[model samples]
Target chain A: MRHLLTTQGLPRDEAIAILDVAEDMAAVGEREVKKLPTLRGKTVINLFFEDSTRTRISFEAAAKRLSADVINFAAKGSSVSKGENLKDTAQTLAAMGADAVVVRHWASGAPKTLADSGWIDAGIVNAGDGTHEHPTQALLDAFTIRRRLHGSASRGRDLDGVSVTIVGDIVHSRVARSNVWLLTTLGAKVTLVAPATLLPVNLSGWPVDVSFDLDHAIAQGPDVIMMLRVQGERMAAAFFPNAREYSKQWGLNDERMRALPASSMVMHPGPMNRGLEISAAAADSPQSTVLDQVRNGVSVRMSVLYHLLSGAVER
Target chain B: MSVRTVLQHADITRALTRISHEILESNRGSDDLVILGIPTRGVTLANRISAIIESVDSAVIPAGALDVTMYRDDLAQNPTRPTRPTDIPHGGIDGKTVVLVDDVLYSGRTIRAALDALGDLGRPRAVRLAVLVDRGHREFPIRADFVGKNLPSSMEERINVRLEEIDGVDEVTIG
Candidate 1:
């Protein structure tokens, strides 16, 4: 619970505890004054080595809502792009008296390296590190699903017997990897559907049922269908034949959206490529929790920051 | 080393009835009064008091929960406290006389947190405090306006208020 580097081995109890705390944060958001005095003298540093406007701003909003001072340090204009190592950059941030650091790097496992190096004596939160994991994204996804399913009675409840079908580029998605592990840990049955070329070869540790046909997964009436964004920039070679074929095969278009059950939820960890991964009809549908996921991301990150940096860190 | 029951079931019932009548008399018939309880056991007491007021004054008074976990001053030092439901009743607390209720009054810090929490929701016309047991040794300059019983005890001793809704008993105990 000290540093949320990965969701691969996160315990069910800790995950549920964070979700329950996120419920409190969501309530605080609805108040007349959307602020809390919880993390009052703490300083949070958003150290982004990668460019993620959505995630960096979400963490910043979460910290500011808790009355914490936030300092955003992007590597684009900083000394990090000038050949300085992570250890040196971390030491500089440590000297600035950062209580927590939300790190987003293009290299996989960079957040883990920052946490384990002891260069910065602060709680490390992995905003996103390549394709390794995005823990808070998964946590917010889980929070949104729990809210949709249980409404006001979501406290202390896990996703037992819930079926979550995640569809998209599994190989290049840290969001898919994080959600597969976390949703299953919360007692959900996860099924991953993607094109064979876009799916990862080494699925030894992923606890999910993989399928090449997206229609089969959608026809089964899952409780939740999450479409991950197809990272076109990550593909060096041609993974799929074409965008039209990919959308026709795996996209959550209007036809695929109609195949879902009435109570089913559609989700996307977005900056969505509409008409490519998910259609405009599906993304703007009433069942789509994409907007709610963005709204709940702040609450989930606030709960994560509160758990990691409230006082003495717990390893 | 031993436990003593200061207020039993009948004693609690009688005390809550008296507190209810006193609330009605002071608020002049519960017209613009909102009864909000600090969570856990105070919610039960607030509901009981609201019911009693309804029976006596024949007016429906809204009762809800006000959680002070976020407004706590000790959050940075202690472990994370799980928050309960902070359900503000339908008509809201703006310009209404809010009666804040709790099970015990000690250290005066929780009430302080509650006051800060109430400030964020909306400004009330007037705010009043009520508690079942007022154990002395307040840290802040806070005093409950209504008290069921004043049991001045030491720091080492614990004041346990068990309600039938949660603990299967209605009694105030000192150990």
Candidate 2:
């Protein structure tokens, strides 16, 4: 509860409590006045070393909706761009009385450092730290899934017995890793699908079904099909043969989109390469909860900020 | 056969008048007041209090109904119909002093969940809990600062608070 750096070690009830609170936050979102006083008078700072429009704006919106004074500290134009160290910047934010720091950094474990360091007496929320974890995104995705499958009445409930297949770019995807840990914790069966290179090196110890064949994984009739954006930058000299081949073998195309079960949902942590990781048809398909996931991101983040700031002191 | 007329309707009305005066006196005349009623029966009670407060101060207080069903921790264990949406009259509650009105206070979980729900609506300047009956069986150490009646009840007996506006009855019944 203190710093949601990684969902890997989170207890099932703790993770579910976040989702449950996010469910209540979702109910608040549906109201005429979509802002809460839970984190009132609290100051939330978005410390972003990485360029992320969605995560930054989502945190900003969430903090603002909760009546928390939001300060967006983009490293692009700030002292961070001038090689100012993270400790100094964190200390400065601490001096500014930041109640919570939502951090997205290029280096993995940056949030862990911020949380562990005594430089700031603020709650640390890892928006995304390199390819390590994006807890809030996973929470929002879970919230979206819970709402779509279980309906509004099913808020505060876990995705128990649900099956999800996360396809593409598992090696460098914080979203995939976070989702695997969180969904599994919430009582869902997760299957990670990717090529040998795109797959993480040591996922055998992870509690999830790993598959190489996209068609075979699709045949399992998963409740959710999450397509990770194949980062061309993350691809080494040669991870996959090419984008075209990857699309043919792994990317969701119109044919595969049509073949998915009627109850199945399609999702993508976006800036999707239209025809590469997911076809336009599938990304914009009727079963796509991608847009809802983005919308729920605000509420999920609001819940996180509220819990970290207002709840009983997190250990 | 029935013992009636202990506290008459007029006496209850006068008590409400006195409670309204006390509320205004304590809250400093409702300058930045927003009354929110916990749902089912609390809304009616809130309406009555809002009317009384408005009558005395010539100020309109924004009142709303909050259904804490979705936010309740024991929702899964307790089988009940789904709660309706919260109806806040204003656009939102960015900087208002929200006085939450409830029929009875038992275990403070409802208010705790309501606080969670209120956090979603907007940040209030302050949230004050006001209840008609403060029945002390608090599992979560929650208490109402303002109370209409301090009725002590046991765990087995349930307090049913009915208001005339909605239930057409103005009495507190122990079941």
Candidate 3:
């Protein structure tokens, strides 16, 4: 509860509680005045060692909406570029009175180090770490799914019996990793569909079914089909034959889109490879929860910050 | 801790009935009336009073919940209070008679925070306070327009209000 470093071992009750609070935060967003004085006079620092504008801004919006003062500490131009370490950077921010720190780092377990090192007393929220976890992304995705399936009456409910098929870039996607742990914890059956090279080697530890064929996974009629963005920069070598060949086999093209049931949801953690991982037709379809995930991101981050900063006294 | 039942279930019903009559008499009718309750127990009491007013005058008054957790002055002192949803009735609070209701009014700080929260929503023609139990220990200059019971108690004592809608019982207790 003190820090939202990872969703890997987050308890069911605590996860449900965060989702329920996010529902309340979403209600506030629906009002004419979409602002709360919950964290007024408190400071939140967006400490990013990696460049993720979407996540940084989402946390900024969430903090500003909650009436907290925000400071965007991009590691690009700051003292971090001059070789200042995370310990010094965090302590410096803490000295400036940061109540919470939302961090996205290039190194895996960077957020956990910042939180447990105790160099600073601020609450740590992992925006994303290198191929490790993006807890808030998983939370927002869950929120979007729960809202779509159950609507306003989604409180106290888990994704029990729901089938989720995550496609593409399983080895390099923190989103896929986070979702696998969280969704399975919430009682959903997960299946990871990717090329053999694109997937991790040791799959026996994960609580999910692995598949090398996207068409067969689609034919099974999953309740949710999440398309992960293929990071071209991260793939130093060729993971697949070509973009066209990958699209023909594994991409959610017009043909694969038609194969999906109408009740099924299409999702993507954005900056999507429109033709590589998912087609424009599928991304723009009404079944796509992509925009819902973005909108819910703000509320989910608000709920996380609320629990970390505002809910501290109650604990 | 020793507990005392200050008001029984029947007592709460009668008190609400009397308060409903008082509100109806004061406003001359239910028109332009909106009863907004603070979250937890006050919202249930507001709905009950609204239903009684509907039965008596055949006028349906909108009842909603106003959560003041964000507007409290003591947030820094205790920063982890869970926030509830603030649902204003349809048509907004502008130019309406907003009667703020709560289970117990003790330090008046909650009322003060409620007033601040209401100010952000809209400008009401008139804002009144109503409470089921009014324990006198006012830290702020505020008073309830309609009170169910004026129970005088020490600051150490806690007033608990339980409604059948939420707690499966209706009674007021002081412990």
Model 2: TM-score for chain B: 0.89
Lowest lDDT block of 10, candidate 1 chain A: A306-315
What TM-score goes with each of the models?
Answer: 0.98, 0.72, 0.97
TM-score of 1: 0.98
Greater lDDT among 2 and 3 belongs to: 3
lDDT digits (tens) for residues A1-315 of candidate 3: 689988899998888889988998888787778898878888999999888889999999999999999999999999999999989998999899988899999899999999989899888999999999999999999999999999978998999999999999999999999999999999999999999999998998899999889999999999999999988878999999899998998899999999999999999999888888899999999999988899999999999998888643532
> DockQ score of candidate 3?
0.53
Across B68-141, the per-residue lDDT of candidate 1 in tens digits comes to: 98788887667767778798999899999999999999999999999999999999999999899999999999
Give lDDT tens digits, candidate 3, residues B109-152. Answer: 99999998898788999998889999998998899999999999
Model 3 chain A poorest ten-residue lDDT run: A306-315
Q: How do these models rank on lDDT, best leading?
A: 1, 3, 2
DockQ for candidate 1, C-alpha atoms? 0.66
The TM-score of the first chain in every model comes to 0.98, 0.96, 0.98
Q: Which stretches of candidate 1 lie over 4 Å from their true place?
A: A311-315
Pairs in steric clash, model 3? A310-B80, A311-B80
User: Among these predicted structures, which one has the highest DockQ?
Assistant: 1
